[model samples]
Target: MEPMRGGWAEEAALAHLLAQGYRLLGRNRRTPFGEVDLLLEKDGVYVVVEVKQRRTGRFGTPLEAITPRKVARLLACARHLLGRDDLPVRLEAVLVHGTPEAFRLEHLPLEV
Candidate 1:
């Protein structure tokens, strides 16, 4: 997909999270090494969510896009976010795709 399409997918992911009762803390939060797509707080836990969206299966599914390296970046961002004595947190991924009215959400919770 193009850059603009990717941006819209992210926006749609954020909206989906909000609709699911996540309290948005930040978006595209940057660190010295990487950036986090969404920082959310829910049920008293800080959630570092990586949003993935795919239009077709020719390449791979969105979930397959997250690599160990990407998880490392997410961990780094979570550490930065936690430096302020915030809530206990975990790393997660939100896979979003499908029609606008029927998107998919896969919350793969990581132990932290």
Candidate 2:
């Protein structure tokens, strides 16, 4: 997919997370295994988030784009970056759709 106009849906998702008290620790964090769109923490629990955007819903909901391969990659990325901070972790996805002027946002927390 093409890059979003201002960063990606990740930016909007990140902003939303921050507003909801999630601390921002990383953005676009990448490793040889995979890339994490947003890394956050809430009450010491780590969160790995995927932000997906679509201009149309012809294919499916934005969340439907996450394949098992993508989930595996996200899990690997989180594990690779876990280091010594063995905090509880949660995987999540953020969906953004519609025109920039009139968009919708939804959050989906996933089980890793």
Candidate 3:
């Protein structure tokens, strides 16, 4: 993806999450295993969200960027976040792209 397009997607996601009453806990949170794009909190539950951005349809849908290997990496990152105790939480994917004023948001709830 183009760097500029990717930036827009990230900004759009931040705005979307904020509008949805999700508190931003952290951004680009990295662990020994991998990195989480956004760590959010809502109603006392944690949400580990992976963000994928695509400007065009050349490769496929933006969500398709997430593969089995990516899922494993995300899971490992989640485990790192839960090092001490079990956290009431879920994994999610946010696909964002398009014009700044007309961005699209896709939320995919991941089943653990």
TM-score of each: 0.79, 0.87, 0.84
Off by over 4 Å in 2: 1-8
In model 3, which range of ten residues has the least summed lDDT?
A: 1-10
For candidate 2, give the lDDT of residue 43.
88
lDDT order of candidates, top first: 2, 3, 1
Whose TM-score is higher: candidate 1's or candidate 2's? 2
lDDT tens per residue, model 3, 45-107: 888888898766777988788887888888788778767447777788889755566667898
**Consecutive 10-residue window with the lowest summed lDDT within model 1:** 98-107
lDDT of 2: 0.84
Please, what are the lDDT tens digits per residue for candidate 2 over residues 19-55?
9999988988998898899999988888999988887
Candidate 1 TM-score, C-alpha based: 0.79
Q: Of models 1 and 3, which has the larger lDDT?
A: 3
Using TM-score as the yardstick, the better of models 2 and 3 is 2
**How close to the true structure is residue 33 of candidate 3, measured as C-alpha lDDT?**
87
Per residue, candidate 1 scores C-alpha lDDT tens digits across 55-98 of: 66678988789988888778878888678645587788878766
